[model samples]
Target chain A: MLNKVEAYFTKELKEKAGILVVLTLLLLVPQYSWRLFFLLLLIASLLPRDVHRGKIKLMVSLPFSKGDVFWISYAFLITIIVITQIIGGAFFNISLSGIGWDILGTLIFSSAYFGIAMISVSLGFGNFGIPFLVLIADSFFGAIGNNWEFTYNLFRSPSGLNPYRMISPIYQGNRFAAFVFAAALLITAYILFERKGTSK
Target chain B: MIVKVENLQKSFSGKFVLNGVSFDVKEGEMFALIGPNGAGKTTTLRCLYGDLTPNGGKIELFGKAFSSKSKERIAVMNEERETFRRLTGGDYVKMWSLLYPKWNDKIFSNFALHYKFDLEQRVETYSIGMKTVFYVALTVASNADVLILDEPTQHLDPLIRNEILKVISNYTLEEKKTIIISSHEIYELEEISTSFAIIKEGKVLYSDTVDDAKASHRLISRDEKASQGEVIGLVGDDTLVKTDKDVGRFPKFEEIVLGYLGGRREFIPF
Candidate 1:
């Protein structure tokens, strides 16, 4: 599994880290703030089709199980998000606690979105398709009222309500509930990847 | 047996691509898989390498059930070269070496130099032919017990093609490696394969030792043939079949394959 992680790091995450840096730089500009969520979506979408051809074949051929791949990918993603958010917060002069809560809030949403993307990709939705759809749906739900309270509040950062907290927005829901939901989705994604691997 | 696939079955969208395909490969044999396009050759290789699990079948590698450990004993160079495009040859090889416990660094370096592979260059920078050569070299370097290559020589020049075959021969002879290669290159397979299995439309048409399969079948004139063989095809009144009685000589490997694919199934002997 370490070999697989190292492989993914060298082949993919190294480039992704550069992209995250660029995205972080953009976050310093107040107007481009919406780009952060999209950046997370981009990271979530990267797992399904990292290679142009034979992605599933290559993944399954490796010694590690699909669940291992999922967990490694998730860990890498969370690490990237945390690091980038910290950098962005420093540049934007946001409080450390504010940025920490913001990272935690985004982590939950990211995991949920990643899970949905994984399930959809396993169901043949291809990379980028499901993640992009989920991002749009999240924004749409955030725009409406309490109909999609879970998704709406998740996307709506409480920090956005304050002038100083503009760069780092925390979620409004029960933090534990969000974490539990993310865990559930992650397990679902793992099961889906396993099923897809077997189905092939 | 190094690899055993028993009654394998696979389907996509309610259509069976491979149905009850069964074959066994010995510990140190060069097994060839031959078939036309969409003939389930790739599917069979995928199942062997754990890329695609068989819906109903048992696949054993190294005397154990197919699992992550089984995969460690197998190295594959699938026809799809578009993967690993992001990594340089050096990085990819380094990663592969880490994946396999018994990686032969000395052998890998020797082949790397022989193939003129630019270790520092990204795979996407190489031409398609060069990429195939690099992958073949990498798989050999893995030093796994079983090598499963799908269309290993596609997009390669004749020179590299011969070189690849030579490397396979040396790998089998010197290291006692087992190879299960799927390719349309019959002449190439003829030169190296000890045994082979021919499949058509997801069904095994024939499976036997190369020498026996060739000796058991021949192309003879309908007017001169005797009884007890399956007629494969007709060529200008000459009937091709797998016969019990020996024709004066054996047919070429290509002749036998073409016979099985295009010939009539009925046995006709004069």
Candidate 2:
């Protein structure tokens, strides 16, 4: 399983050069842009397009099941996100509080992104169109106010005072609810992908 | 039996690809699935390997339910070469060795040398024939219990094709491995296959051992176009008849196949 995870990471590195380059460029952005940059890169790293339907079929046909492939890829993407954050933190000279908040925020954001990518790819939404559509949906909902907080603020930086922003980096503002939301999304994605995995 | 598929059905968007297709492959037998294009051969094979779940029916391997454990013992060569084309041949094999528990490095190295496989070149650089050979080699090297090959000779030159067949035959002979090969190459199949199934339009038209099938069905030039003696089918003026009585001798494997396919009679021997 460890070998499989390493193989997936190597494969992603070779296949997702564009995503890596975009994530690298995010480091040069100003401090204020760090929130958006981190979110964008988190979402970008989780784009399911790196593994196509053919590759999925091949992978699933191996000694691993569909869930195995999903979780392995999930672990790989999460690692990439962590490494990127480490590099970004060093370059931007973020304070301890900022780094702590960024890590938590990135985890929640990545969980949501991972869920969306899994559902999109498994449900036959072409990989290229999904991330673009996700960004659009996020902005649309974000513009609608806190009423759609759970949906719109999925990738936003956590706020300590804002109750609507249940999942934040610093102060615990309904952080439990945020974790539950993330868990729900991840579980739903797993169920849908496993169901869609039924042979055609 | 090593493989048992009962009432297997599959469809895509309401269009039936396999309508209750079923067959059993005994241990150590080379079972050939012969059918024309769009005849559900590939779909059936996919179902057997659990690559695709059937809409209905049961598939058992080694008397247990099918799952990843079944997949571990099965090595498949699909019709499409949709592999990671960016990886070099050596890298691809290395990746597979990690995934397949029974991978045999020594045997693979020996076979690669004997076949002159290019391990240094990326898959994209290889010709279609080379790609086919490379993947087939990878599958064979996995040393799985069951091997499912779909159109293994699709894009191969005659020399390479013969060499591959020789290697496969040697593997089966030595290992007693069960092989399920789906191909349009009937004559090639006749050379190695112990039994075969002829399917059309998502249904099994005939399933029997090569000798039994030949012994039961005979080609006769009869007048008045009579569909007699359990008429299998017809081709031009000849009629293919399956009878208990000796009709001199049965036709060749290809002749019997053409007779059954071309003949207009529907004989369901389930």
Candidate 3:
């Protein structure tokens, strides 16, 4: 497992370095929304492009299993997300005590987007096409829900209160639903990835 | 058997690419899957190495069902020679050394010396022949029990191509390893391959050991009528017939392959 991780790191060192540079530059932006959008774009572009470009063939041809490949990529993406969150918090002068919840919210939000992107890619949607469309739809719905009372009420917490509203405004409804949705998409993507031919 | 593929089926976008392909390789044999382009040779190799999951059928490696653990015993050189393009040859060696438990640095070094490969240069800069050689060298040094190489001799100068074929043949003999190679280079493959399966249009046309196939089949002249043998295919004006009695001249390995693959085409005379 460690060997596989090391192999991936060495193989993708250049791409990873480029990602880090772009991520750091994004963090420098004052707008949190813009930074988050670019971060999601980066995450969405990660695994799908590898599959599309037939890089997965090289990885599977080695001792690594398909599951190993998927989990390693996911782990690497999560690690990047965590590191960038920490860096973003520090850059924004957010106190360490106040950063944990924000980091957790970012993880949840990013995971949901990652799941969407993964399933889209697995279904033969190009890396950027469907995921970008979903992002646009999400923004459109969120904006509409903010203005319309009925739509806003549907997405609002049952208790009429959201403690993490500032962190995760997307999941304004039951957090359980958010978790389930993310889990379902991720599970579907995993199944599709495992069953689908890597020749694509 | 070192490797077994039974009734393997695969399709791309509803079109059957591998329509029930099957073959087996014994231990220490250089088995060749010979076919023209788009004949499902690469697809079969991909399925054998777990690069592509077959839509239906079974693939067994080393007497058991193929799985992730099975991959540990196999090394593959894909048709595309896919690699991390930005990485140098040295980087690949380093990465593979860590990944393959049995990787032999000495073997890789020897290949580098012989090929005069610059370890510092990225893989993308290498010519197609160099890249093919590089991948072949990597697979050989992996020290796996089985090697699945798709189009190993494609896009190479004749001298290097022969050298590569000799290296492949020697590796199987000296290391007692099983190799499943898919290629359209019938003449070269016939020289090295012990067993062969001729595939056409996603189906196996003929499969047997090189010696047995040659012994059982004969190339008869077009004018001669063979009443004692089953007609396999045509080679120019001559007919390739499977026979028990010595009727016509025994077919060369490539003649047999060509007869099987080209036999179906209607000979048009102007």
Candidate 4:
């Protein structure tokens, strides 16, 4: 696993360097909303880049399996997100203990989005198209749900409210339900990636 | 057998691309899969290496069911030659050395030197032929037991093509490794491949050892329609027939492949 990670890092050195620059710039922003937006953009684009470019087939041709690829990529994404969030919090002089929930929330949100992006890519949808559309719709609805009580209740009732609220700005929804939704999405994405024909 | 594929079926959208393609590749033999475009050659290779899961069929590698572990012993060079285009040749060596447990840097370096590759330059800067050679070199250096190469010698001059073919032939001979190569260079492959399977429209029309395939089939004059042996196809003024009787002259490997793939050629009256 370590070898695979080292190989992946070496292969993607240039892209990772560019990501570091973007991340540094992201740290300069004071608003969490903007930071989250850019972070999600990074996740949406970077996580599925290999699949979109048809490089996943090449990767799998090596000793690595599809499961290894998926988990390694997902773990790498989570690691980067956690590390950056910690740095951002420290740089802004926020207490680490107080920001634990903030970090968890960000991680959950990112995992859900990553799952959606991966599923889209595995299903032959371009990396940016479906995920970007989903982000737009989520933000639009999340905003309305936050501002309107009736709208929030309508979404929160029974029609898959937990998954939607996971990405919403309002933190009043059930966290457990959100976690289950994210887990389900990631599992489904992994299965699709395993079964899908990776030849390009 | 090193690789066994039975009743392989694959469909794209709603139509079938590979309908029950089957073949067996023995250990330490150079097996060739030759066919025209859209004959499911690349698709079969992909499925063999686990790049594509067949909708129905069985693939056994190393005398066991094909799995992720099987890939550890298999080195595949896909048709696209896909890689990190921004990375240099040196970067590939470094990355592959880490990925492949049996990687031999000396082999890769020797090939790089022989091919006159500039290791510092990005892979995208290399010509198509160079990229193909580079990928082949990497696959060879991987030192795996099984090498599945799809169009290994595509887009090269005659001299370089022959050199690549020799390198492939030598790899199997010196290392005693198994190779499943797909190619349109039937004449060139005929010299090196020990056995071959001619595929057409997602079916294996004929598969046998090079010696047997040539010995069993004969090309006779088209005018002399054979009363013995099954007629395979027409080749210009000749008819390719499979028979045990002493009739027409023995067919070359390319003739047999062309007969199976092209069949009877239709000419337009001008």
**Candidate RMSDs in order:** 5.7, 5.1, 2.9, 2.8
What is model 4's interface RMSD?
Answer: 1.8
Off by over 4 Å in 1: A14-18, A24-36, A49-56, A59-65, A86-101, A126-129, A132-172, A197-200, B235-237, B246-248, B265-270
Off by over 4 Å in 4: A27-30, A136-172
Ranking the candidates on DockQ from highest down gives 3, 4, 2, 1
> Candidate 1's residue-wise lDDT over A48-155, tens digit each?
555222365666665555665678777777776777678778878889898887777778777777777777777776566666766665555444334556644665
Q: Can you tell me which runs of candidate 2 are displaced by over 4 Å?
A: A21-47, A50-54, A95-100, A128-131, A139-173, A198-200, B224-228, B265-270
Better of 1 and 3 by TM-score: 3
lDDT of 4 at B203: 90
Model 1 chain B scores worst on lDDT over the 10 consecutive residues at B78-87
Q: Which numbered prediction scores highest in lDDT against the true structure?
A: 4
lDDT of 4 by residue, B154-246 (tens): 888889989888989988898999899999888788889999899989998989999999889889997776889898887777989999988
Q: Interface RMSD of every candidate?
A: 2.8, 2.3, 1.5, 1.8
Clashing pairs in 2: A158-A168, A199-B52, A199-B53, B233-B263, B234-B263
Model 1, position A186: C-alpha lDDT score: 73
Question: Tens digits of per-residue lDDT for model 1 on B118-231?
Answer: 888888789989888877877888888899888998998899888888889778888999999998888788899989998999998889898888778877877875466777
How would you encode candidate 2's per-residue C-alpha lDDT over B1-270 as one tens digit per residue? Answer: 899888889888888989888789988888899998999999998877766767898999988878766777888887886666467777778778887888998878877887688888777788888778887888888998888988988899999899888777766788899889999888788888888888889988888899998888777776633344787777555677887666634778877777766667545589
Per residue, candidate 3 scores C-alpha lDDT tens digits across A149-194 of 7856777567655433322335435555556666666777788888
Candidate 3 lDDT at B124 equals 78
TM-score of 3: 0.92
